[model samples]
Target: MARKTSLKDIANKVGVSTSLVSYVLNNKDKENRVGKETADKIRKAAKELNYFPNLNARSLKTNISHTIGLIVADISNPFFSSLARTIEDEAYARNYTVIFGSSDENNDKFIKVLDFLSTRQVDGFIVASPEESRETVLGLKESNVPLVLIDRYFSDIVVNTVMVDNFKASFEATNHLLNKGHKRIGAIVYESTLLHYQDRCNGYLEAMKQAGIVDGTQFLAKVNHQSLQTEIQEAVQKLIFEDKVTAIYFSTNTIATEGLKQIKNVGKKIQEEIDVVAFDENLIFQFLDVHVPFVSQPIKKMGQEAVRILIDQIENKDQGIINVLLKATLETKEKLQKVN
Candidate 1:
């Protein structure tokens, strides 16, 4: 490997005093009266030597790491992964490095990652507050950690939060099916014990009742992550076979994907026979055998905005809590006329 170069070597090569070089490199020369030509030469020489500033040591003097931590419920989900990449890119543009951690939807792992990142001297944080970690939300306020919650919100906690309007989004999706003449619409949701999951289910019920469907079973179906397909297949099968559900609405991308698979397995002809709509976005929906209506959440925009909020809170030390509700867009590839 080539020898590592230092500021002293660059100063000697550029024929300038080390103090002058330091002043120029640190941008302190504007007040020190150092000539710009000498500063330019020092910069050129440092570049040729591939000299990198010691940010770690410099951060110690300023008491700011210029870094942020991003924690999510699950990194495997494309929505979260896309959000992470967007946030990382935005943070990079702001000269901030972002570290990521996944909570795995477990309180233990959530607390562990929160504790681990807290020790890193991160300037701020962007967190997806999982439902099981409500107390953690309360504790964050006391820790003086600048925070922005993404994809979910706590009604009781005062904090900066950015997320799609889960209730409105799900409600609109169900309303779309109802407008398409779907009466016996079933909904599939995935959540262990989170309130946001409950919100989606509630939205489905509200929409069903507003459409005059009083029966309860058609409005609710809960599934775990691993048994997504099995649960969807069983629930949808019952809706088709026993409950006489002519349509279904999924509350997430994962559930939507499974719902499509179950519908296809039962028979592709069923697509023309029944109506379907889902809360989240997925590529599968884009190419489904028949055009099914679905709701699109702006995942990338949410990620970018969350980082901006976190940075603002960190720099301004403003404790004002904000709840930004982004609207969801609805898409339908096939125009199925209202049948109800």
Candidate 2:
């Protein structure tokens, strides 16, 4: 293989000292009082020589790897996949790289990924924590590792977090169904201890209460995340046949997809036999013959804010903790038509 180009080669081509080239290439020319013309010359020569700085060496010197670790519940889920894409774009714009991992809602897997990323010397983390991860999150905080929780966070943990107001979103969606004469509406949510899921469940219950509908538990169904396919189908059966709900509210896109599939299997059509509202938007929802209104979270904003807060914490360790709860909007093409 041909020899790798080095800073020395660029310096020699530009007729400058290696140190001067280093300062210019590392964007320290202003502080070092290097002339702009000379800095330009060094940059031009470095480009001509195809010089690429050794990130490992620079990291060793500055103690910054310029890498971020991102942990999500499931990368295959559309919400997380979209969030990850937005995070990648935002991090790239800020000159940082991201390493991604999926926890699959398993705390053990989450810890393993965290350890692997820590060993790789990532500068910080943006995580959508799974259930029973309070201790793991607290440990990271105690260790002074820069972290920002997204999508979900502990209510008592004091840390940087950026997430949507899930309770408000769910409340509005449930109320929308209620406004359409859906008194016996049901909700399907994950049976997890994560605060976000709990907030969503509470939102649905509160909306039902406000509508003068007592006994919300009769219409609410919780499914195990590990067995979503089977459990979601069972929940749909219970809600539709047993509870005799005319409408259903799904807490997440994944749940909504599976629930919709189960609805189809039972020969029910959306807005015809039953009205449906879901927490997050899915591409498939738009293509269905009927409209499925959903709560739209500001995904791009969430990702950008998470990266911003995490990077800020990484750079300024003394900065105060930040907790941001963004608002989600309910998107509907038209008013819900009550099923007879």
Candidate 3:
């Protein structure tokens, strides 16, 4: 094993021309019409010899690599990790390979990943978490690159997106607390720039306004993505001690988990002293001593949908954007209480 297996090696074993083997392996011969028997033989030989086509060579010939690039922000996040698994599975099923890249919320890294994927000549792209703008996405669109947006989407750039309806989900979560006799409801939000985060804030604002709770000075707190736990804990203390917030709604998992830890750290009774509801569901539910409601997003569906959209675009070269706003479900363990 000095070198990897090649199409020529498989062709030699099958007693066929390299071009014939290439066509059969790549599935590029429509007029040549490869026979099932010949195709099967070629495939069997390739499999036995562990012959994998050189993607570069195949790409040069067909201008397609049967591969896709997936870019996500913060793959460490459980939500993104779960989505990545689902997308990889879907890509495997379609005989397409996937390469993953993480931006880590850095604009320069995001641009670099886009450039890398483009230079590699990936057949399509599944973009997960774009920072703020869609200049990169728009550039891909103009170049006729098959792109599928996932997790978060931008209205300005017309690309197929698969994500949960953040506004409605957050609204429902807020309304749940409102119906549960919680008047002074506080919120712990992640950073700005992300559309999902903004939608979540908008939902909270709408719910609070509808309840005629106008004074929002101490009711809202926004925490940066990094060092979220400390910032959220400080904000929660402010809401509880200074502003006297009775109950709190968390916008996402990272914030909710940290806020929960802070509440317990302060020796406050969760159910009795402060009630809580969260948007992102996690294993934290099992550890909680009291009933807590969580909004569950179909993360696996989002991943599968991203793959579907990308493959469809690659096959059909579709121009119109397909926006899929998946619905969210509320999982509640406590009885609903009526608020005055």
Candidate 4:
């Protein structure tokens, strides 16, 4: 392996003492202990040499790992990927590095990831999808491992979290479909015990009831991740052909995309025979012939808040748990008329 650039090398290149170079690079010269010209020369040489700080060495000196563990549902999904990117950028600005892992919404894997990160001495963690990992999260709290949940949270856990109000978001999105003159609406969601999904499910039910559609069970379908394709096809066929549904509300972007594909395979035109309103936003929705309505949360804001909360806990800046609830924005391109 190629040798890495060291601070000593920068000091030697600039004809300065190693301690002086360290003071300037670490920005510890606020007292003007080192001359400005000398500092500038050290910085220039460091940049020229592509100098990078050794995190391990710094951890030993400062007792701060300066690394954060980020565990999310699925990084491949646009919503999670975009949110993770925002969190990473925010953490970088605070002199922290981000290490990522995908839990695939599996509780066992999520716990394993947390343990592994703990072993590596990460300062804290920003986690999402805590439905089945209730005990594990509670354990983290008991252990005083600084952690913040993003995207999903458990009321039973008493932990810091940053997320949009899933219930209100889903209710508004479902109401959007209802306002477009579609009475027979179907909803597709992930089959989970998580509060996030349950909140969305309740929101859809509330809207359907408000619209005088009492038969809620017939219009909703839930599927696990392992059997997404088959279940999506089955749900779409049943909802469209058997139930004569006019529109569908997808609780997430993942479910929406799968539902769209199933609709196409069943030879249906979007907004013509059926309209859709998804809970999360994705760029792929723009390319569709049908103007798929979508709800977008403050993804960047949530990410930044997660980092700030986790860092605060890690530094003992906050003594109490913080729960941040944000709002969602609905984006619409076209409205669907009632099917004759």
Candidate whose lDDT is highest:
2
Q: Comparing candidate 1 with candidate 2, which one achieves the higher TM-score? A: 2
| Pairs in steric clash, model 3 | 181-339
Model 3 earns a TM-score of 0.78
The candidate 2 region of ten consecutive residues with least summed lDDT is 52-61
The true-structure Cα RMSD of candidate 4 reads 13.6
Ten consecutive residues with minimal summed lDDT in candidate 3?
52-61
- In the predicted model 2, the residue pairs found to clash are none
In the range 1-340, model 2's lDDT, one tens digit per residue, is: 3455788898889899999998887778999999999999998886566454453343344477789999998898899999999999999999999999999888777876876676577888899998888766776665567889999988788899998999999999999999888899999999988889999999999999989987798899999987999999999998999999999999999899999999999988877788899999888987898889999999999999999998988788788999999999999998556545
Q: Give per-model TM-scores.
A: 0.77, 0.80, 0.78, 0.79
Instruction: State the C-alpha lDDT per candidate.
Output: 0.76, 0.87, 0.80, 0.82
The C-alpha local distance difference test score for the whole of candidate 3 amounts to: 0.80
Name the better of 3 and 4 by TM-score: 4
lDDT of 4 by residue, 21-69 (tens): 8788777765658888888888778757856544334334446778999
The list of candidate 4 runs beyond 4 A from truth reads 1-62, 335-340
